[model samples]
Target: MTASVANDDGPQGLRRGAVGFGGVLFQSITFMAPAIATALSIPLGISYAGGATPLAVILALVACLIAANSIGQLSTHLPSAGSFYTFVSHGIHPKVGFLVAWGFLLGVIVGGPFLALQMGFVVAGTLNAEWGWSNDTWWIWTVLVCVLVFALGYRGITASTRAGLVLGAFEILVFVGISVTLIFQAGSDNTLQVFGTHYANNPDYQGFSGVIAASVFTILAFIGFEQAAPIAEEAHEPRRTVPRAILVSCLAIGAFYILNTYASAVAFGPAKMIGFTADDSNPWQNILARDAWGGIGFLLVFLALVNSIIANQNAANNSSTRTMFAMGRIRLLPPEFGRLNPFGSPMLALCAQLAVSLAVALFLGFHYDPVTGFGLTATILVDIFAPMYILLNVACLMYFWRFRRDEFNVVRHGVLPILGALAFVPAFFAGAGIPAFSFITALPKPLWYAGPIAGIWMVIGVIYLIVLNGRDPDRILETKRVFDEA
Candidate 1:
């Protein structure tokens, strides 16, 4: 493997692990797919425009597919440990690359705690319901889960992937079972109306903007597809596996979401679905329990929610540590961060991630109710990450334009990116606007808004880069060269 080192030897290349296509696919599905985000996206879709949620997802999927293809083009050319940051830097300019790295790193780091907190909520909810346990100390358990993730992640990519696979498979099976059962109950009429345009004919949601706002939240359902690119270095065949995993994951996730959301809508009916609001705690789970499975179904949904949180934590850990390792290797941080465990894991980087997560959990746990604390923290993390997610879409367009010149037809590279940008940019604004809107209305504010928080984070990154450049011009130059040659 070609090594790019700036100081001491970088973290050991991914250890030869037993993970294959199945493992990778499983990891992608589990880590990215099994979250409450997926389940709740149904109601979120309804929240946007009653029935247009699936259409929004379909549009988002098409947009993301184009972006993924652009990313795929880059993955084939240069599969690296750095993923999007590396690809964007090489494909575009180095400065933008640095921004990508910083944004992604912040997202993963903040997101780890958010995931842990969410898991804590699910566990607490389950235990309180089942065993009559107090959920007062949920943060303690959340921290323990985060610690477990930190330990497993420190072991190596293979261990993380393996764990992700098992969890992912279990979650998927549960989701399928629930979805299938719901569909059978709803029958064909409900299903057809759920997917059809009749739901969007509401007088309340007059224009495309309302539908777009609703769809934006629904798009969150598919956020994890990008996880494939970040872990490309661990794949046996980066060119083939990375792209295939992304495409397959997108298709599979989209199909599942459409079916699931349609079923949820059909089962609940349009009038009832409209009545379901965000204020209802565990609204989607409640809907599922009430309508579909009764008491037993509620228990199953609760269990799935707990598992989903755990799976998301594991995924966030894997992504955050690798991103830190990548930055460290490039001399953007201390050389120690680039060092590997005997098992070839980025131990220091993993520790860094855990440390940040612990601090966030402590702060949230102490300051607010468990649900509010976790929700705020998770929103902040998502807010920090969302712009980069948008940027990655833009990066995809630029990447294809530069490297895949032959395939850079306007339809594939230009038009699709525009559509993605259209889908994402408005959501980005809404993500930012919602916080302020909440503050004005005295609605509880989301922990973080994606636009401003991400902007500030990038500004800090730029300042850090300038200071580093002043301290070590030569190293900065070398870092610039890493992308220049390509």
Candidate 2:
């Protein structure tokens, strides 16, 4: 009944109100993992968008904003850890909700290792860049990070958030400062040329399709916005804090992306747009090392990359565990997953998720380089995530516009959802088929990378949902009830 921090008297055994709006906001922002995205993700986006990287970023921002608004409205009603799964269930059907939960859980469980896999190389690269010593074994770093994430998450939400906030804030400050300095140094040459239409023909692109393709990858940078929703129940005044945190993080990160992309493009100037990003993974470090505070900037950028991955993993751990914890409570998953530790953390679920993450990171580490593994995992996740977003977008319209007409409005619930759906449609289709990142050289199915994986996972979800509905209708009802709770 309290709107503050969870204590020993808490009802569900999980700590409640462990943090406020700032805690949720920082978690969401860090979840986007902007520091590394600006450093690493910019190259992929720039290579695709040609000279129009900024425009691609803008397109991605608008799309994400539209989607964020849709989920924003949904969060105002059912503030649950299942997040989109909860929203879709109440808004649509229980069966579909089960599928979303299945797919999303699958994504995040692997997402930990996916992000961690990349961080491994980031750590190795940083060591080499800073101290002039090379470590060929990146998997060692992956193991170390996995331990830290699982251990920190095991402690409690408050400890995890405080650590993430401190590291996340420093990472953002250094990256943002570097980007702003880059912009100011451009002076007259710093035109809105980054947003120009000329990129489609800039001698490097395959027409406007390149920009369209680039928008798909850059859109991933805004992903952490939704992470706030999964932790809504842990927030102080969730209804107010969750939606505000989500929208604000979404837009704020979007602005940073636009400026960051523009500045990076400016660093390469107008002529080298294609050449600058092609095959370059360390663009941010490269530019920073060339600046006045070269040595300090290099070290900070490297640390930022390292921080980005850890913070992102911690954020993902918080989200994935809570979703599983909520699932376990409702019998959607194993009862063990729902069990809380004496310290109020979802210990069993943390171990379960961490095991899967470490296993995948080690498996991929042995087979491929970090970039390829990261790209492959990210491509698969995109396929999994798109449907969740699409369903949530449509579900919001169905819930507000049709079922709860009293709460429906022309703009907030109706137009925004439709716009969000419209925006994601093309991007979803364009990306779901191929490996958008060049670094990802191969897939199990060469012709259709994500299509097969996405299809099979979805089929499995449908089968499971059907079985659960047939065998345990009461549990289905219970799951629905969880979302309906105020």
Candidate 3:
């Protein structure tokens, strides 16, 4: 798994043993941005699944855990910065690996503006509601935080993961406490029925269909659980650490989502939960927080959201830049992207990521608004992520079957991967609004552009791959090489 050096000044490789299991685990946790998801995603789920949002969350959690198993299994064998890129290249075909690299990078790139816009939107909305401040200041916060993310990331992997650990712990504690309190405060309203299909009351997609529909959105909350895999090279005992971190983060965050959803359903009234997102003026969570803990509770929730975004961006930047560095090291991208600064960071990739994020956030934000722009980017991310996840599962099966046959187990390598891939099928169709199912609702008109945007990005990647292959057919094969493998 040694990286081949072409010359004297080739990539120095990421700082090995820079972080331990705790840092790796928190990197995944923070990247998922639990506080942000709890504050925003629950209401969105409730609107579609009513009181059965908890059930949908549980289903999504199961699917994610299944998918995580495949990712974890792959990480044990190939703990590289390229992550899915490495997994697919060796497990599947090198050409497919290049495509995965392309699509995966698209998810990471757009993920920048997606979280940045949300950070600004959350801050501006909180300030406007609490202190009568202008919401227009969102752009300023967006730009400032983009710079902060770059600065922290450039400092090194240790610094980035350490910051994420502290910030992730605080946000998780805050939300968990609030969720438990909300559940207890519900008193007689609390019931196990929220997890049953009967509570799914969405008028457009009733009962089981409502739960299925909401699962599409609920799955988004699990997007970053595999983030630890990308930084496996920098982590201590990565073969052990990366897999455990992925599984543990998924279970922890899954529990957190269930607790929050249950609390929200019971406290809001199960049948009336569909109205949860109707009144943007009076968010139920904020009102409940204020009622439960006075003014300070409201402020704490807002602070958690802000802290969540910062930590989320920090972890995400780590993953994206390292992956870029890996790709560049192998000549899939320009060599400049592989260069590390004096501080041991992928300097060029970091700069490019933040710059593109800032530019896209400003452009789309000014064209429409922060909220709409955030949604568009998120939609595109989900589109890219769903297919990539399926591909990863297939890669897992092929990797074990082709190369590790002696170690292969049918349950782990075959059935589980197939099940994981199958799990995303319903959600993908519903999210894409393909009209394949009568129960699924179409995406909003404004967000309809997400599909074509993702398609164009993938097509461009194919064209670039074809051109690169024509120049040197074996270049794509370098993606399988791992540097500093444990």
Candidate 4:
């Protein structure tokens, strides 16, 4: 038997073995942006799930873990910088892989401006609230953070992941500490009832229906757990490291999410938790922080938001740029995007991504305000991401069943992947306002455009794939040839 050639030592020149287990772990952790998710995304569950928000988080965790299992299994054999694109191309067909790559890039591309708008909004708002700084200067902060992320990413994967390690660790500690303190301070208010259907008091969506509805938002919070797969080509012993990073990050952050949601419910008094999103600003977390440690806790939480955005964007850029580089290398995109800087980083792809993200963010920020623009980008992200995830799960099942049949287990490849794909179905329909899911209720205006935009993008990708095949069929053929042989 022959050993497979490691992806890290490939011809891509992306600094092989530059990132270790810890670095790989934090890449996914920071990308998930646990602090931001806890402060913002988690509370969306409360509005629907009411006091049973923790139950929603647990359901989401299970769904994400199932999907992560499929992703981890694929990464073990096809650890390419293309990540999902690589997996799908080799596992399924190259044409479908091209579409997945295109759609996945659309999701990741918008993620940049999404987090940039968030950073600017959070920093500028915090300063205004605390020190009377002008919140109007958000665009300035947004640009600065984009530049910082670009610099870190350009320096190389090692530098960016190391930065993520520090930023990710601090944000996690601050949120975990505040959550524990809130739980303790709740005293008699803290109860396991928050995890039960009895406390699901939302009039519009209560009991199991509420939990299912809220899991949509909770699942979005777990979006970046598979980010480690993109950096696999740079990871030390990627076959082992990448799989561990994806699974562990999902489990760790899932637990972190559960704790934070429980504490938020208890601290705010479960009966009134349904009103957590009453204020568009969602000030409950900040109020809890201030009550716990006075001014210092408030300051730390604010800083954590800032840190989370920076770290999150940094990790996101690593994934997007590398995937772009991978596509470019295969001639699915222009060759320039495949080029690297002297530092062995995909500088061209990085520059192109930041330029586009910054422009989009600034236009949306000035046009509709930062918060609104942020929501728009986030909605678009979820629309693009949900389908891509379902596709990946399908690819995993196909890969093992058709190619590696002898090693395939019915439970791992068949049942888990089917369940993983099914889990996203309700969330996707609800998010897109399919009307079939009556429990979805009213959605924000941004979602109205998001679904259409994602559809247009997919149509465009299909057109492009057709043209690419006509012009140069070898490029698409080469995708499977490169790794399938390895």
Best by lDDT: 3
Off by over 4 Å in 1: 1-11, 16-18, 129-131, 201-203, 206-209, 277-280, 287-294, 434-452, 473-486
Q: What is the C-alpha lDDT of each candidate?
A: 0.66, 0.77, 0.86, 0.85
Write down the worst ten-residue block by lDDT for model 4. 1-10
Q: Where in model 4 is the C-alpha error above 4 Å?
A: 1-11, 441-446, 481-486
> After aligning candidate 3 to the native by TM-score, how far in Å is the CA of 449 from where it should be?
1.2
**CA lDDT, candidate 1, residue 118:** 73
> What are the per-residue Cα lDDT tens digits for candidate 3 across 1-486?
323223338766777778999999999999889988887865667778998999999999999998999999999989999998889998899899899999988877788999899988888888888799999999999998899999999888888899999999999888778778888898988899999987888888789888987887788888899999999988989999999999999999999999978877887788988888677633634776775577777878788889999999999999999999898889888988888876678888999899899999999899999999998988888788888889899999999999999999999999999999998877677556666777665788668888888889889999999998899887788988877553
Mind giving the per-residue lDDT tens digits that candidate 4 earns over 198-222?
A: 8888887878888888888789899
Question: Weakest 10 consecutive residues, lDDT, candidate 3?
Answer: 1-10
Q: What is the TM-score of each candidate against the true structure?
A: 0.88, 0.92, 0.96, 0.95
Better of 2 and 4 by TM-score: 4
Q: Candidate 4: deviation at residue 387, Å?
A: 0.4
Candidate 2 lDDT score at position 434: 43
The deviation in Å at residue 262 for candidate 2 is: 1.4
TM-score of 1: 0.88
Candidate 1 residue 293 Cα shift, in angstroms, is 4.1
281-387 in candidate 1: lDDT tens per residue? Answer: 56556666556667777777777777777777787677677677767766777767777776667778888888888887777776776677766655555565466
Residue 142, model 4: lDDT of 95
Which of the numbered candidates is closest to the native, going by highest TM-score? 3
